[model samples]
Target: MVTPAYRMIRIKNASSIMKIIGFLYIFTIASLVGRTIAALEFNQMMGLFTPGLYQTLSFLALFLIMFVGNTGFVILLKEQVDQELLRVASFDDLTGILNRRTFVLLAKQIIAEHVKKQKHLSLVLFDIRYGGDEFAILLPEANEAESDRLVERFRLSAVQAGIPEIPATLSVSRGVVTIVPDQRTTLETLYNLCDRALYDAKGNGRNGAARTRIAL
Candidate 1:
């Protein structure tokens, strides 16, 4: 039970609480072994070991078990609950993609980094639903030609996936916008330009993409 509990408390990124828990786990196991040896009358086999030491080990192990069972379980449970809440807040329920709110937040950070690095960034918007649904993709260091190729590949892949309900070829309209990000660039500006390109694709008819490049 203690071994499994120790494994449960261990996480990929170790924290202070994890370190404490690990220490407690090692101490508890050692104390348990000591207590077992004392119980089995193995004390005579070992020289210069006091009976009081076994009593102390037994008491300390019991105390540690109680402490870990109460506080450690609660901490792990709370961590799991917080992670689930974050996942719910950050992702779309149906599509399992980053929702608009998370997208905007991360997009700002990406824009700042790209501006600092003086790199190209591309944003693609398309509808994924049977009739219509919106999804956005951010491509770092992608230029106009690469973005266009990606859009065409995605369009072809969707058609090849072959949804049974659609009698005809699946049509995916995409808006592709590429820019060398600067201090003046913002997610809102990029979104607006991508939206305009999406309108252009829709205007041109289905199964096509519209490309736009921002100078600044």
Candidate 2:
């Protein structure tokens, strides 16, 4: 979740760079204008060199400073923009839950480690369609007995999680797929199995849960 504090910190970081860039701009302008006027008078009196040549060189140096500062400022701004965009893409705006893409990505990372430890992994999905809802529960380490219990509980309690966009409370069907990770196990496969289970629950009735375990 993007907490206020985190957002504020990002804002502060971006603001500080903008301030630096602004100061550099003002300083660069002031230094060049003041120096050029003085250098012109000095050259006129001395009659020994091209008018404003020294000021031009100094202006280039100052402009370089401003240019570098602006570059840094742009980089900082881009970093913040990227972070915000990633956050938005990864989380569902209405439910504040991990979006499907993010969930699959993180779940895969978990599976990679769990497989090394020979641990069981669970995947639960909630489907809210047909104005009804259901749950799908997957327990990779769970036998039929354990999955049955969890599925029953989900059937009884699973509700359609609401978002601000919708006013009416909808129902959901839950689908679960459990698997022991191996060479053939993939995120897409898991999602597909779970999604199928979700449909099964919907076929039986909305507001129900289904469980499926992949064979090793």
Which candidate has the highest TM-score of all? Answer: 1
**After TM-score superposition, what is the CA distance of residue 190 in candidate 1 from its true location, in Å?**
0.5
lDDT of candidate 1 over 1-216, digit per residue (tens): 567547646756665566577777777777767766776775434333545676677577668778875797788678779889999999989879899999989989988999999988899998655768778999888888888788788888987887688676767889889998888888988989998999898899866789776655
Indicate which candidate wins on lDDT: 1
For residue 210, model 2's alpha carbon misses the true position, in angstroms, by: 1.6
TM-score of each: 0.75, 0.48
lDDT, residue 139, model 2? 57
Q: Model 2, stretches more than 4 Å misplaced? A: 1-82, 129-169
Error of 1 at 50 (Å): 6.1
lDDT of each: 0.80, 0.65
